[model samples]
Target: DTAVSQTPKYLVTQMGNDKSIKCEQNLGHDTMYWYKQDSKKFLKIMFSYNNKELIINETVPNRFSPKSPDKAHLNLHINSLELGDSAVYFCASSQVGLNTEAFFGQGTRLTVV
Candidate 1:
């Protein structure tokens, strides 16, 4: 019984390809976010949305895009992917941002060959 689950725990693809990851949460949370964790395990917030409304986008490249069709679901779409984009993508959920604890999914490993 996973609370928040993301499709394709591992993804391998060639460079300059496009990929999409689907995410969903059953915790009834109102806010969700997408984070990137590099090889160094340094985590950073990329995009956040609440109730299908995008609320935060921080220093992320245009190739990465996030879409939330509903409060419990947010999907990631990448265009023209690159080798540098290889990393673990995490989907997280929170009641709210300020001083709130966000639950993270296992993560999807994207490898650009």
Candidate 2:
């Protein structure tokens, strides 16, 4: 089974629309995160949740929201999407406390026009 999985691997939408991407992990981890990869392939963490509580949040715009329903699930929602939001989104999970290797799901590429 995949350690992490995301739905709608590719998304194409018009500007000003709203969209959501779902993610799940089966690795029994306590921390889940949402990351965005820009065209230059720079990965930046947008939000992180540990044990269903927000632990880390970068300076992402209010348009981006991350929700974690459980320890193994994290979802991202974007409102009034802009062309600048076009990028690849990845979901990752890792155990909390000690340093552990993170597992990433196949990224979801979003294109806004």
Choose the strongest candidate by TM-score: 2
Best-fitting candidate, measured by lDDT? 1
lDDT of 1: 0.94
Candidate 2 per-residue C-alpha lDDT over 1-113 given as tens digits, one digit per residue, 9 for 90 to 100: 88899998999999999999999999999889999999999999999899999988899999998988778889999999999999999999999665688899999999999
lDDT of 2: 0.93
TM, every model = 0.96, 0.97
Candidate 2 TM-score, true structure as reference: 0.97
Worst 10 residues of 1 by lDDT: 94-103
Give RMSD to native, each candidate: 1.1, 0.8
Q: After superposition, how far is residue 64 of candidate 2 from its true place, in Å?
A: 0.8
* Cα error of candidate 2 at position 37, Å: 0.5
C-alpha lDDT of all candidate models, in order: 0.94, 0.93
Cα error, candidate 1, residue 91 (Å) = 0.1
